[model samples]
Every structure is written in C-alpha cells, then in structure tokens.
Target: MSPDGLCAHRFRHTAITRLLRARVPLRSVQRYAGHSDPQTTLSYAQAFDADEAIADVEKLDY
Candidate 1:
C-alpha cells in the first residue's frame, strides 16, 4: 500500500505515462486505465514545456 493509500493507482499512473510516451492512442489508454471517457485519460498525460524540449534537444548534439 502506498503512503497515500493508492498503491495500485501508482501503477496505473506509470502505465499511463508509458503509453503516452509510446504515442499510443488516447482512446486506447482510456480503455486500459478503465476510464469511461478519453478525456479522463488525457488528463494524466505529461505536460511538456516546449522550451524544455528544445533545450534538451540542443544538448543531444554531443
């Protein structure tokens, strides 16, 4: 059990993150997360700051 009493839920979040990173369909992620609607799954997707992504990309030229 998690300190917040959401042990299983943490795994769900991790699964959702993995699916989002893999570019899986949002609808498919909704089904996997057992949400009745895609919007709910979409809410869990990581929010990317464009500036951060660009900075990270620039660092990859090593």
Candidate 2:
C-alpha cells in the first residue's frame, strides 16, 4: 500500500519526466503517456530545455 496518496500518479510523472529527459520522441512519449494533448508532454520537455539553458548560461564569459 502507498504510504502517501497518488503513488501511481507520482510514478507516472517520474517515468514521463525521465523518458523526456532521455530525449524520447515526443509523439512516442505521448502515446506511452496516453496524453490526449501534446502540450502536456511538451511541458515536461520545457523543463529539460530550461535546465540545459541554465547550464549554457553558467558557461558565459561574464
């Protein structure tokens, strides 16, 4: 039994996040996630993009 509620929800979120981070195809991920809206899957991709952007900014000569 899950100590906290929505453990399966958390698992799905983590799985989707990891899949996105692994650069899986968006359409494929959407199918795996069963998301009707691609935007929902894209939202996870934005986080990965933002993280890479942050790393790039850190390398600035400033």
Candidate 3:
C-alpha cells in the first residue's frame, strides 16, 4: 500500500525518484525501471529536484 492508497504506479515513480536522488546513473535507473525510452526515465528526475533543493538550503546556517 502506498502512503495515500494502494497504487502500483506510485511504487514505480518512487523507485525511480529514489534511485535518481541516490546519484544513480540515468542508464542504470532506466534499466532498473524497465523504461523503453530514456526520456521516460528522465521525467522521474524532476521529482528529485525539490528534495535536493531543500537539502541544499538546510546546509546554509544563518
């Protein structure tokens, strides 16, 4: 079950996002995600930016 509800697609999205955030190569993520097109894997990369931005901001201390 997903956080909100049971949805298999969410698992796919999360897995891809997590792999990207972990600095996994795009090709590896694509293969693991079973994506036929690199573009599909690239799309999941966007999900990681927000979290990365927050982490970067946290590193700054005023």
TM-score of 2: 0.62
**Regions of model 1 farther than 4 Å from truth:** 1-6, 48-62
Clashes of each: 0, 0, 0
lDDT of 2 by residue, 1-62 (tens): 47667667778888998987886766678789998766676666656666663554354343
Ten-residue stretch with the least lDDT total in model 1: 53-62
Global lDDT of each candidate: 0.66, 0.70, 0.72
Candidates, ranked, lDDT? 3, 2, 1
Off by over 4 Å in 2: 1-6, 50-62
**TM-score of candidate 1 on Cα atoms, chains taken together:** 0.60
Best by TM-score: 3
**What would the TM-score be for candidate 3 when compared with the true structure?**
0.63
Clashing pairs in model 3, backbone N/Cα/C closer than 3 A? none
For residue 25, model 2's alpha carbon misses the true position, in angstroms, by 0.5
